[model samples]
Target: MSLLDASMNAIHLGFAGLWVGSVVFLTVAVLPLARDGAFDAAPLETVTSRLQWISRISALALFASGGHLAGTRYTVDSLTGSAPGYLVLTMLALWFLLALLVELGSKRLVGGFADRKVRQPAREARPYFLAASLVGVLLFLDAGLLSVPTAIPF
Candidate 1:
């Protein structure tokens, strides 16, 4: 790989890790606390805001780096015709789903926070976050599969 390709791959992986980690953290940690009324509205709001920012920034970074890597590494025919290409497409789909789920969950939390309702918002947002977490995990697994060499040539 060229240095530029390697750098883009690193950036892509880093942002993917960040995005997935943040979603998992929110789902596993923050949501439960918020649901239990452990956090006040202001703190919940701040947390949600930060989560949204992370999601948005990560989305953009992943898209840019992923696009570059894809463009350099695969042609339209290769992308459509190979197992690794399908995995890439799957990752792309998972990325979109993750982004959508996070956005929906954040909106729910923000809306509830606006009304000074922390627990309710957390409750409402829980399903979306849970789904996002699952998608994130799947995305990582797909990436790992893509990275491994097949015993038989494709």
Candidate 2:
């Protein structure tokens, strides 16, 4: 790989790490505290708002660098016709789903809090948090697979 490719890979991984790390932290740490009323909603809402911005930027980075990496490494045939291709395709779809979930979910949650000045019920927030965690897990697994030099048949 060229220096540019290496740089792009680094950027892509960095963004993925940030996005996944934040989601994991929110799901594993913050959400439970908020659910139990141990944490205040106002501050969490502010943090989520800022996190949404990071999510957006990282999503863009993922898209750009992932596209570059895919283009350089695989043709349409190989990308579609192989095991690694299928995994990559799944990862791409999950990435988009994650972006939508994080962006839209944060907006809805924050907006609800803003309008009512109250914390969202744990039951309501559970589904969103679970979805995010699932997406993060799958994305991380796919990334791990891709990182294996011998995993791709090419």
Candidate 3:
């Protein structure tokens, strides 16, 4: 690979790792701690907001780098017809789902806090967070798949 290709791949994978790690951390650590009352509403809100911000920025980076990688690696027909291409398409779908879940969940969580004068309960937030985190995990797995050679030659 050219230096430019290597750089783009690094950026893409870095952002992807950041996105996945943040989601996993929030879902596994933050939520459970908040649920157990280790973190009060105010601090939990701040942490959640910050995590959301990081997720947003990381997602943007991923999109940009992913686009560059896609352009370098794929043609339209090959992407649709090949195993690697299909994995890429699946990753794109997972990326979209992750974005949607994060956006809507953040809005709803923030709105509930505003309306109720308190953070949304962890139980209420759990499903959304879990779903988003699950998507992140799927993305990570898809990326791993992309790194390995497929049985079917493309």
Candidate 4:
């Protein structure tokens, strides 16, 4: 790979890992605490805001980097015709789902936090975050599959 391609790949992978990790952390750690009243509304609000920013930044970075990689490496025919291409498409779909879930979940938390309703908001947002975490895991698995040369039959 060219240096530019390598750099883009690094950025893509880095942001993907970061975003997924954040979702998992929120789901596994923060949300549970908030639901148990371990976190006050102000702290939970800050956490939600930071998560939103991370999700937004990561989404943009992945889009730009993935777009560059796709443009350089795949044609329309290949993308629609091959296993690796399908994985890429799957990653794209999962990326969108994860983004939407995070947004919805964060909105719920923020709204609740605004009213000093930590536990209720955390309770409401839990399902969305759980789904987002699952999608994030699947996204990483799809990416790992993409890296295996023999996994792609093209």
Using lDDT as the measure, the top candidate is 4
Model 3 misplaced regions, further than 4 Å? 115-120, 151-154
Instruction: Evaluate residue 56 in candidate 2 and report its C-alpha lDDT on the 0 to 100 scale.
Output: 90
Estimate TM-scores for all models.
Answer: 0.95, 0.88, 0.88, 0.97
Q: CA lDDT, every prediction?
A: 0.90, 0.80, 0.78, 0.93
- Model 4, position 138, has a per-residue lDDT of 96
lDDT per residue for candidate 2 within 47-128, as digits (tens), equals 6877798789998999999999999999999889987888889999999899877876676567657454325643366577
Count of clashing residue pairs in every prediction: 0, 0, 0, 0
Note each model's CA RMSD in angstroms: 1.7, 2.3, 2.3, 1.2
Q: Rank by lDDT, descending?
A: 4, 1, 2, 3
* Candidate 3, 52-71: lDDT as tens digits: 88778887887888888998
Q: Which stretches of candidate 1 lie over 4 Å from their true place?
A: 151-154
Models ranked on TM-score:
4, 1, 2, 3
Comparison by lDDT, 1 against 3, better one: 1
Off by over 4 Å in 4: 152-154
Model 1 per-residue lDDT tens digits across residues 26-144: 99999999999999899888888898899999999999999999899899988899888888888888999999999999999999766789999999999999999999989988887
Tens-digit lDDT string for candidate 4 (1-154) = 9999999999999999999999999999999999999999998888899999999999999999999998998899888998888888899999999999999999989988667899999999999999999999999889888989586555
